[model samples]
Target: MTRSIYSFFICIIFLTAYSCKDNPKHTDDIAESPEQQLKQRYSKLVTYPLDSTAFPRSVNLKTNNLKKVPSKDWTSGFFAGNLWQIYELTGDTAYKNKAKKWTAFIEKEKFNDRTHDMGFKVFNSFGKGLKIEDDQEYKDNILMSAKTLITRYNDTVGSIRSWDFNKKRWKFPVIIDNMMNLELLFEATKISGDSIFHNIAVKHANTTLKNHFRPNNSTWHVLDYDPENGDIRMRVTHQGINDDSSWARGQAWGIYGFTMAYRYTKDQRYLDQAKATAAFFLDHPHLPEDGIPYWDFDAPNIPDEPRDVSAGAIVASALTELYAYTDNEYYLNYSKKVIHTIKSSDYILDKDIEYPFILDHSSGDWSKRSEMDEPIVYGDYYFLETLLRLKDLK
Candidate 1:
């Protein structure tokens, strides 16, 4: 009886393996023509309303009195950006109107007082929204936000100041994350016909290109400068395992930002930088077999360190853009690979058919005080945006 049972189990195992081998939906088959599959998936995903609220408005902001926190700003702006992308893809008035409302909310926050993230919170929320809708009010608000951002740019340091409270102590303030924010300045230049914003944006980009990016294309999160003389004082990472360690999100920001810079300036150096950074990010040993990146590339030392789906989603979205810019099949293929990996991985929350949250194990910040290892609003937004970009790409 024991021998018969063992043989039966072996037969079942063999059948299962055979079935999997013959499965038409195997990873390689699905990924072979990823762009086509991505478009199909995107059509299905975007047909459903993720949130039925007012335009530009977010369901994520239902939390109470979350004052004095950058997370609130980041989340709300990120949502607005995603909504704008949705409107662009669907051409649905509902998404466009929601984007308007959210941009108004961000405008009401008074851009003048904002610090480091004014570009992100305003550009993504207001500028990008207005670009889609062509609302004059939104355009005006974006200009105001640009002026606010310009104030943060320190002429002496040749870069933007990240935090004012650390004002007198540190200068030459540049962070890998700030690369994402520079879009505000670039957009302002186009909208307002002001070269000042462009100059500052280029200066910040040049400083980062010269200082923060490492030889291997991995980047330091923060590079402190001597306020007095604008000399490089230290290379540090605010959210990584150590100063020398590579942060996955930071690398994603670099890839996206440098590619964006290339798009704006048509500069080969920016493209080269973006490609190098992309290589380091995709080639990291710590990257999961599924193609999702951990919260930090060096996070293996920390037990149970969460992965950042936000980083992976942003990188995938940027990779799509990179593909469009370069028409490189490899970039397009990589973007699809990452998206498919996320979709198939256990991290994706598709159980809630009504509101599917794409990807999991996303960390706002594991080492610091954040919603560490939770499904972040931005992660979901970027994932959806990536799907839309895939759908629209020719």
Candidate 2:
């Protein structure tokens, strides 16, 4: 009886393999294209009444609920930016109407000076809107947001203040992520022909280049400066595994920031910095073969840590632009690899998934145990941006 059962199981396995090989109508044949997947996801998202000042920040893992953020939140602009990108990508009127409506919710942030995230808030939404259709209102809001951002710049420290809440521990903290905010300043210069904006951006980049990096080109997440004498007080990490460990998203921000700087200034130093930083990220031993990175490179549990899809998406977008500048096949090919990896079943959400977001399984504030293993708004934004960049490359 045992021998008969073994023979029957063997025949079944062989037939299954043969059927799979012979059938051209497998799931791949019916799977939606990436563009189709995006449209379906956004169609679901637009069904929600997100017209208030509330924006989707990330999903709550325990409750499986989408977290709504206030308009003043640092992540306020990404959802609208995602909408704008979708409109540009598919030329869908539904997306354009939603983009305009959501972008209007963020216009008040142009006068919000409490945080140094104007670039993230204004540029991601209004800046993209202006780029798409050249709305005078969008352009005006962007310029106003740039003015609010420069208010955080300290001429003495030669860097923008990253946080005001941690005042006791950090006198004048400058996070590496601040480098991304400089895009607002650069754009302001072009819009107004004001060299002050350009000068501040250059000085900030120079100061960061001098202090924010180690000998190996890995960056610290934060650098605290003494406002009194323009002296470095401390270099630390707020979101990384430790004071010395590299945060995956921080590295991505560094890569994208320097690439953007190079685009604005045509500065060889920024380009070199971008390339070296990208190498540090890609050549790291801890990076997964699938192109997604752990929450932190130095996280204690290697291979078991949560992957930050936001970091992967940001890196893919930045690498595509870097490819345009350098014409390097490595950047282009690696970015394509990342894009494919993100589109795999592990990262991309199914149309029926309860989460109304596109990408899944991003690590947000892992140390705080917040938003762990969920979809973040910025992840969706960067994923769309990466797809658009890839389309342009094609």
* Top-lDDT candidate index: 2
| lDDT score, candidate 1, position 254 | 93
Q: What range of 10 consecutive residues in model 2 has the weakest lDDT sum?
A: 1-10
Q: lDDT by residue for model 2 over 211-313, one digit each (tens)? A: 9888888899999999988999999998888999999999999999999999999999999999999999999999898888998999999888889989988
lDDT of 1 by residue, 181-242 (tens): 78888888898899998889899888889998888989999889886788888888777878
TM-score of 2: 0.91
List runs of model 1 lying over 4 Å from the truth. 1-72, 166-172, 301-304, 351-359
- RMSD per prediction, one decimal? 9.1, 7.8
* CA lDDT of every candidate: 0.68, 0.82
Winning candidate number (TM-score): 2
